[model samples]
Target: MADPSSQNPTLTTPPPPSSSLSPTPQSGTSELSPPPCSALSFLKTANRPKLRVTSEFDSDSLLFLNKVSCKLFDNLAKLKLSFQNNSQREVSQPQVSFTSKHVSVLYDIEEKNTFIKSNLDVHPRLQLRAIHNVKAQQGEVAMEANLTEPGYSLELSSPVPIGYPRATLKFPLGEISLQEKEDEEEEKQKRVLSVNGILKRQAMNGICTALYTDEELRLRYAYKDDALSFIPSISLPSNAASFAFKRRFSPSDKLSYWYNFDSNMWSAVYKRTYGKDYKFKAGYDSDVRLGWASLWVGDEAGKVKTTPMKMKVQFMLQVPQDDIKSSVLMFRVKKRWDI
Candidate 1:
């Protein structure tokens, strides 16, 4: 990186003879000549800031976690096996994921809710991630496993939570000022503060901060009443100088809106509940332009449910093209049992 302030060789010119100097009209001092920068300005103007696209996912789609919980293995003492698919794909292209949790309601070894949740990803690449939830009455300490994906380079992490108090004052247009500076080296990242027990886990807590670099994580801060919250965070990679806005009218209300934005992109989403087991979401983004609005109507609807098991069957009409003859008929059935 050569300094732009340095003089350029192509712009240099020989000085005129002293005898050719003309007296200044306003002062005794000789009139200063034009700066060398004017001639070599093209060399500096050639450099331009590069444009960057941050996120790869820029579409509007429905995302749901398909999970089945079974207690058939309760003979193993509160041991449960759960298989979940965490991918956003067509029903024909579902992914594979598994989880196992050992929980005790009355065991006082750690707490009444002493539980260990572990997840394993078997396909695409074998990976494992686990969290230890050591909860008490007021505060809980969570320890995360330091594991890496199967095919990636060796990832060794020793996660130590360095918790602290963070205060934020919000301004309009998603601009914020922080007192506790973002971590400089990003060596030992801390965990973000959460109000899961306090606030019903509706917010993604760290919002009113800046992401200094790629190593520094851009955390989502949870918002409280009057658009105020005190949350801490661990460093994650993000664009610099981004802002988030959170607003909730009431504490007991489940409806909330969150908008996060930086220079490159922005996104906003709001979720509301109709009744107990039904909820819908409406959102828009700068990306995900409107595609052809497709619709599906059919007569395949049957579900059977009891206290211990559930079964559902549906037939969907998939039309990738505008022509009706090109549509494909699909049938799906799901069944699960509990003991």
Candidate 2:
């Protein structure tokens, strides 16, 4: 017998190739990474702040205050809440936004600072804002306008349909000046009155002052894709104008240039980063009137374990200014803890 069963063999087929359209699932935390952008993009973002609590400890302030023996409110605790509706497709109900923050000196438990704000969409094109800044008092009803002071402020804005411009009207009620010295002193604690109306469009934005000034204009452009940008703006009734350019050559290298046309002055800056935790910037400004150079270094680190905490510190130096002819040294630090 020549093993007839073994001679007759079975044929097995291989599996089909995996499609490139779908990502393969992995066992661990293997999520897709985020998209890439320029090194300076983060500085330009008008990011809507999120809800969080921050506990800060400023070592420089601590040292300076200790040196001067005027330590009052250095260490701080801050709580901020911000919420908004980011949906675009659904437009049935009114869109809304809320933001509030409370800040207090850790050492002084009684004194506190608070800011409450709200934005509501009256319609698809109309929006309203209300903001207040007054600490809560026991058994006292907080009114829309602070009874002791006019701390209430409002803003109304109407944005045109997509592809159009936006307009805003600001009513700084808290900014009103008083006639009497007592009234002025009372209103001094509140926000100063500087009402304005603004019209904004892509690449161009303008502002018209209500209580003062004629107008302000801004123009922006990108000189290179993901690499360079230039912004120029001028203010009227003051004859002030500025033009600036920014460049991000790589993840670790950046540069910027700024010019004050009215002053006939210009400045240039360069920045570099190392790994993920360190960054340094150096720059110089020179003109027919004045010139100086400066440098800054900052670092941040975090640990996400029990009693979560974060710390940030920065050191800065500037050369020659304001009668005295010597380099000035400055230091700042901040630390945060979860509540």
Candidate 3:
């Protein structure tokens, strides 16, 4: 406490500023530094399509499902239609059969013969004139020779009745042998048909050319609004032939075709599979088709017999797989038999 003014003369000096301070790192460099990788990232690469994984699902099971889907896709194919005969014969020939051979050919032949016999007595000139007039009105001419009074010329060939003379005679076993022969002949006739029956030639609506079973009858497909439709041909004789048809799809085979069908009652259909069960379905549609019946008689002077025959056409479809079901659309006649 000596003099306060004298103590003020002894004040200390201040310390110097620091020169060793370091510069801060750049913000861009810090942000770009690689981050620590996760355990899952080591297995994931950039090549394949991304796979979703679950705890309970094994990768192998996923791979199996994928493969199955691919196989199924490869097997899917187009649908088609064809025909089969009574001899268990599958013919690729396009034909539509209405009744089976046993029922159709015989019955039709009988019908034709009966019709001819009933009308044979009528004057041919009258019939021809009527037909000719009709054609003339339609602005057309009859291409064949004028049908005139071709008198009762009758001859039965081929399917002729057997043992006519002998069977009629009275003998010990004559009746029994005749009966046996008759049965044999009947069976033979039922089994035999014209391998290449006369083709009924006709021009349909100009779309598809139909090859008729009994004759050359051509039906056409009518195309409208990206849909294919059927147009039946005009038959010369209404009772000439019968038609039949079927449709099927082979997703695995890639096939689709239709033969002779006077009607559109059959169709090829498909559906989505239910599951691993591989279930399927099918269906058919009814579309009318036109056909005809024919009878031919030869000139009377030469003694020619008219062989009247009826042809049956059948249509069917098949698939390779066994697990498919079929659903039908509708069976209808787009056209009718034209006489």
Best by lDDT: 2
lDDT of each: 0.35, 0.42, 0.25
Query: How do these models rank on lDDT, best leading?
Result: 2, 1, 3
Best by TM-score: 2
Candidate 2 weakest ten by summed lDDT: 64-73
Instruction: Determine which window of 10 residues in candidate 1 has minimal summed lDDT.
Output: 51-60
Any idea what lDDT model 3 has?
0.25
Residue pairs with backbone overlap in model 2: 55-336, 57-335, 175-192, 175-193
lDDT of prediction 2:
0.42
Per-residue lDDT of model 2, residues 261-336, tens digit only: 8878888888887765566777776752333443322344343122223445567666644544656566665444
Candidate 1, lDDT over the whole model: 0.35
Which lDDT tens digits does candidate 1 get at residues 113-208? 543444454433333443454463332232223235332222122222443433232223232222233454578754433211111224354334
Model 2 lDDT at residue 44 = 39
TM-score of each: 0.28, 0.41, 0.16
